[model samples]
Target chain A: MDRIPILRMGDFLLVTIQVDMHDQLAMTLQDDLTSQIEKTGAKGVLIDISALEMVDSFIGRMIANISGMSRILDASTVVVGMQPAVAITLVELGLSLAGVQTALNVDRGMQRLRADVAGKEADDGRHQE
Target chain B: MAVTKSEVIPIRTEHDIVVARQAVRRLSVEAAFGLVDQTKMVTAASELARNTFIYGGGGTLQCESLLEGARRGLRLTFTDQGPGIADLSLAMKDGWTSGSGMGLGLSGAKRLVNEFEIESVHGQGTRVTITRWK
Candidate 1:
């Protein structure tokens, strides 16, 4: 029942997803975050899937969508803290993320987000020259 | 022992995704492989399943185990009778995605497996083949 939390860490946006591992809830949460990515335009988004016990196709595609759309919206996104079981399941199902950036922990994801934002900003500045 | 196993599993909804994962795991475990091979196969299958359902509306996943003279491996084939890919090359490129994919479906699957092939015809459907070994 607890919704995903979106917090701004400097220029980056951290999304803390508290999952119940329930199928229906995972679907709901994924939909909610997908829309949030569009509405907030946060520079960076991090998803904490540590509490998640399982992720089906719907949720998997939704996560992929979130990361995909975030780029279109000019925001960077990373998935953090996936359990070994969940990671293994994802691999077996061939749902392994191709473009979505993932980090071992929330801190590392945030650091990467910060770096990504800085790199993009630097690129933009150089292009303006 | 030249024992070959092949079956076409359907992917209708999200639950089917779990079944697909299980099938792949069983195949990998039966071969007595390590975590890396298992992980790669699983990851590649996951992306293909997602693509089949999302883009193809629904489809079938075919898995074949090849054990030819001590060379043990598995081949995964995903087929969908949905709208075929318009641009195969671009779709395979990283960061290029259709619908909600993170632009990693095809390319990501490619990296996870030893061999990858995709055949599609516009307005027809798609067939993706991937292989992994012990």
Candidate 2:
């Protein structure tokens, strides 16, 4: 019954992974995140992984799946706060997380999301006019 | 060189994979490996533990702490009685997976450690050994 909480902050959903997630927990988070995005109509997702010391291929793939699903649902995902060691291990593990965007920290991630949403809205307004 | 200390852990389910990672991390830290080295070892352990559970059906992990001369190292040996791999050369290739995984488990784990070895018998089982020296 352990679940990672998904917090909605205005137009974005913020997920801070603080535990050493097992495979089931990672899968559940993916499902919960997509459902939350649909229900809230969020435009962006920011995943904080600073607290995670290790990231294996399974967890890396889960992040990619979440990003891809969010993209299809009209949302952008930014993975932030990856530890230097974790990043090195991920690259060595051959999981580049191809389609997902990353930032140095949560503050920068939020700024990036805000700008992305604002840009999308501007494009939409132009199309309407 | 002989291992100064060793412990054996079972890999039966998903939860065991997490435990395996923690054990590897602890051993790597105790060996005085840097943060990057510890993370690499732990990540490799996670991949192998999952492989043991999902592909091998179940297995045992032996973690050993080694002291060779002035160098310290951590070594892990995973053995499973499941159906053995028929094509080791192909399995070691990147992006080659018999399961739903990204196929990076074997090759990726190899890249993370300083030494890697694998043995399999067609009908018997598989054994993988890896070591990282600090």
Candidate 1 residues A82-120, lDDT tens each? 878668756654577789999999889988998998999
Best by TM-score: 2
True contacts kept of each: 0.02, 0.98
Worst 10 residues of 1 chain A by lDDT: A17-26
Q: Candidate 1: misplaced stretches above 4 Å?
A: A1-25, A30-129, B1-3
Q: lDDT tens digits, residues B103-131, model 1?
A: 76787778777889999999999999998
Q: How many collisions per candidate?
A: 12, 0
For B53-129, candidate 2 gives per-residue lDDT tens digits of 99888999999999998999999999999998999999999999998999999999999999999998887889999
- Interface RMSD, candidates in the order listed: 5.9, 0.5
For model 2, state the Cα shift of residue A60 in Å.
Answer: 0.3
The true-versus-predicted C-alpha distance at residue B82 of model 1, in Å, is: 1.4
- Where does model 2 sit among the CAPRI classes? high
lDDT of each prediction vs. the true structure?
0.77, 0.95
lDDT of 2 by residue, A51-113 (tens): 999889999999999999999999999999999999988998898988899999999999999
Stretches of candidate 2 exceeding 4 Å from the true structure? none
